[model samples]
Target: MARGAASERDGSLSDGVRPGEEPADAAPPALAIEGLSKRFGDGAASVLAVDDVGLTVERGSIVGLLGPNGAGKTTLIKCTLGIVLPDSGSVRVFGADVTDGRRAAYANVDAMLEGARNDYWRLTVRENLRYFATIAGVDPDSVRGRHDRLLDRLELTAKADTPVRELSRGMKQKVSLASVLAGGAELVFLDEPTLGLDVESSRTLRRELRRLAREEGLTIVLSSHDMDVVEDVCDRVVMMANGRIVADDTVAALRSGAGDVVRVVSADVDDAVVATLRERFDVRGVETDLGAVERDGDRRDGGDRRGPTAVEVAAGGDALYDLMDALRAAGVTVEGIETVRPELEDVFVDLTGVEPGEGGSDEGGSGEGDLSDAAADSRGRSP
Candidate 1:
């Protein structure tokens, strides 16, 4: 078995999912956010970025913070990390009041927010790690030992002597991440750590992040716009849109949202046939979209009636046999069960309607909503 996983090479390994096959019931919370709200500028034109949102992240568990562009995810994260002060809210990192304690509380916390804070352009990757570890008050000698191992694992051993300015974006990202681990932080915060990495590098980073969190018993809070990243990495997910938690549940629980999408891949699927599906399932989701595709429709889209599709309802733990039975009874052709599964992309698109940007910046764009979900899902809320 892989560390923090049900199986080796399981998608869950890189995805950060722990389905708890134990057959037991209930678990403890690791990190909790309570009634957290952060508003920028006050009064009349105050922009409410993180409004009364909360959720819990468990020890030795991976959780994802998801939302669309301008959803105030960054603001909330900033507030949690003490980078931004909240108007009214509280964030607990490893059970510490993050907004109140400041540096002392952050001593046990290590983060690579926006993946940009880890580098020293003049220093080598190894040098950077040494410097950060030293500053974090970790033993100097321990830095050397850990540096070698991190360089090897991150495939940066060859680049140990390379200047940060010379490395590629992905390489820099790896180095930055290594610095976080080097600090020996008990809790890790990574916001889009793999944003620009290539596929292989991204996969390795994901795999390693999973291993680090589980095997080392590190608590992690990860924010990402990639549904695959979130779907694969989180044990549970907390979604924020228009500055609030809209959906909070296990990935398995969220997949239940996609309990309806059925991918057909046997022969040709013509327009008429597609049209036939439209009449039955909410076919509006099938249109060409620039965003990631989920099993049924959008989970992050945040639009009422985002689109309906049999694929989504098909997900919520429903058996494919039942679906085939329904399809056949509906007079729809059964092309061969290519695969019956839920799509996280559909789940994300459904709720926020847009991909989450690095920060709630205007460049990535924001969602359209008159949200009343101002302060939902705070960890304080009773389950």
Candidate 2:
């Protein structure tokens, strides 16, 4: 309630959801940030880590924050949690200024932030949970009632007596997460939560996340570079570049919305004709997945006369007709053409104006940044 008191009052803020659709008597937003900007250093030496970014998470939803490395995601999260102060911007949790850093806000929001620290290496897993519960102000009797439940769910019950130093890296990560929830939080932030996890542990966490979101109505903010995890877990995603939101929508919409991959399958045809057809097209990308002897099992004698080739095309836009005409003029025969939806990776690549695996922040970030040195120091050890 301290910094974001005016966010709701602005009346111009965008929720993306249609009007009158907000839940009746809904519990206040789990988190909100407006006109958020953060910078590091000063003058020419300064860099903007977050730039006028604003977003709101409704009462219960799984939201994903994604971007290339150094895209300001970590900075935004740190500021929102009041671990670091934004040079200019306001943060609110449940309609209260998060800047106040109230005990309620801290209790209501538990994050397995980047570089999340685990329990003391000398203590057992159970001991670690108890220690964190005490720090979060949880009553011993209350924690005792639910202790076994969480341990079992995380598959840590067997290691309850094992010292933290002896636990596997993934097990410790799970424990760090469990400790955050032991105090009871309505909203949770998981930054690269599955980074060090194996296939099975990752699956377990995914199931747990879905359960919490659907059954417990917990609002979750997840940040990760794992495309599969984000695609499967988030209800919606917000992508950032150069500290600004470049795209915000559902995974399905983003994928199908980008474009289609069209594949054309044809029978025996001339080599020169197919070459002419391909040369005339302005496709985004094209590839030939032809088999050893082509689809008709006709082996090319390595001569100039080539058989028909399937032209798999992408970017269903202009210049298609030109290719068709060229092929016809060159005496090429067409068999069939098909189209398929793009994948989530394709959508992200298109929206961010970057190719897969080569994406970078639209703009460099680094001015007036917030986040405590301690938290950041801890995040360095997350993976």
TM-score: which candidate is best?
2
lDDT of 2: 0.67
In angstroms, the error of model 2 at 313 is 3.3
Please give the RMSD to the true structure for each candidate, in Å.
11.8, 6.9
lDDT of 1 by residue, 195-313 (tens): 78999998888888787776666678888777788877778888777887888888888867655555542122344555655565544333322122243443334254232222222
Scanning candidate 1 in windows of ten residues, the lowest lDDT window is 372-381
> Which regions of candidate 2 fall more than 4 Å away from where they truly are?
1-24, 265-282, 292-312, 315-337, 354-373, 376-383
lDDT of 2 by residue, 1-383 (tens): 01111111111113333333554455567788899998877789666879999999876689999876557777888777766678898888878786665554555666675543545677888886776566555564566656677788888899989998898889888887777666556677887888789999999988888876765567899988788999989999998877889888999988877766666654444455455555655355433434433435555442444333566555366545655565577665665566777777767776666543354332243221223234534322222
- Off-target runs (Cα >4 Å) in candidate 1 are 1-30, 42-44, 115-117, 262-281, 284-339, 355-383
How well does candidate 2 match the true structure, expressed as C-alpha RMSD? 6.9
Q: Give the alpha-carbon lDDT of every model.
A: 0.62, 0.67
Q: What's the lDDT for residue 372 in model 2?
A: 24
On lDDT, the candidate that comes out on top is 2
